[model samples]
Target: MIPITTVKYPVNEFFQTIQGEGLYTGTPALFLRLQGCPVGCPWCDTKHTWEKSDNARVSAEAMLAKTAPSEAWAEMSAVEILNVIEAQGFTAKHIVITGGEPAMYDLMPLGQELEQHGYQLQIETSGTFPLHVTENTWVTVSPKLDMPGGYLVRPDCMQRADEVKYPVAMEKHIDALDLLLKNCPPRQDTIIALQPISQRPRATELAMQVCIERNWRLSVQMHKYLNIE
Candidate 1:
């Protein structure tokens, strides 16, 4: 096996922030945003992360100092990452691995390093890439349907998801989710959460109504509303 210190991934941004959505909402967490994604959801908030450029790679300090989202990233091994986290003095014990599709890179090394030091790890994924994190990692699979990228949500992802946080903008979105559920069923105990697209009033209303009717959870992005991170 390759040493965990030798297995590196592109690190876009690493900071301390409150969990903005899904099941871990409001929880203080360390956010690790990886760089690079091919799943082109037109509504992607972090479009800057969609492409990885060799020229854009910078030092860890440069990546962490970014006040705005950009394509700039650092190539970091699991060991180097832990050192930065500790040096930053972040109080959060929960770490959220997010991105331009975090599952695009194997996370076992990262997961092992974090969990060994008593940190809880979570991943917010689009359900397009096969997961390679530790079994103990909390997996939130946000199913992206019929996006421009044309990537299909894997059935194995649905099965592995601890929560299915689907984004909905209209009744048709809910209809699509229903079809997906029928075709690629999640575990019986998986939490089903609906997040409104861009928090539009109509979208929020539709999400709320559907959540009420289906007994699913509604995930309002509190961080966005509270002006945090």
Candidate 2:
């Protein structure tokens, strides 16, 4: 494993694309997907990123060559990541640091560097680990419940989040979110969004009803709808 102090991260992939979900949906952004996660959601789309191994230690070029899901990753220092962004000529000012659980590693250094360079940073996490990003970073916590991984959402993680984007697949999912909201009253600025799982019709219907009843917002996966990554 790469040392956290070295400012090196195990990267699964990086690409410039539209923000797929949550509060920043439809916005042009650069996605930095880090590798490794143990909090397994049964419907997880990126199962390939669940483990880290020697196969993940590849060159940056080889990492970018991947056009499909693979258990491959590359270690990249913050400076090297910035170079790649510049080389790619990404014009988006927003940088989304997502992962197999981004909170599993410290993100303060990278967040600080991105802020210094005038880039806004956002982190998408599962809210199972303590957050360590800059205050300016937008933290989106999509809490996983009753998943294969037995990890519970940490209250501290919820309190630190700018938004709680919950995936709704059934009534039980909404009930879990309700219990979570009651347990952790979010900050005044915290946005609560309900995203339908896999864009299922039943899930979408449930989300819409709940959002209306609770006066929360709906976050459809626009990227998935548009057939984009």
Q: Which candidate leads the pack in TM-score?
A: 1
What C-alpha lDDT do the candidate models reach, one value each? 0.93, 0.89
Off by over 4 Å in 2: 1-5
Per-residue CA lDDT of candidate 1, range 148-207, in tens? 888999999999999999988888999999999999999999999999988899999999
In Å, residue 132's CA in model 1 sits off its true spot by 0.4
Q: Which pairs clash (backbone N, Cα, C closer than 3 Å) in model 2?
A: none
TM-score per candidate, chains pooled? 0.98, 0.96
- Clashing residue pairs in all predictions, respectively, total 0, 0
Q: What is residue 145's positional error in candidate 2, in angstroms?
A: 1.2
Candidate 1 wrong stretches, greater than 4 Å = none
| TM-score: model 2 vs. ground truth | 0.96
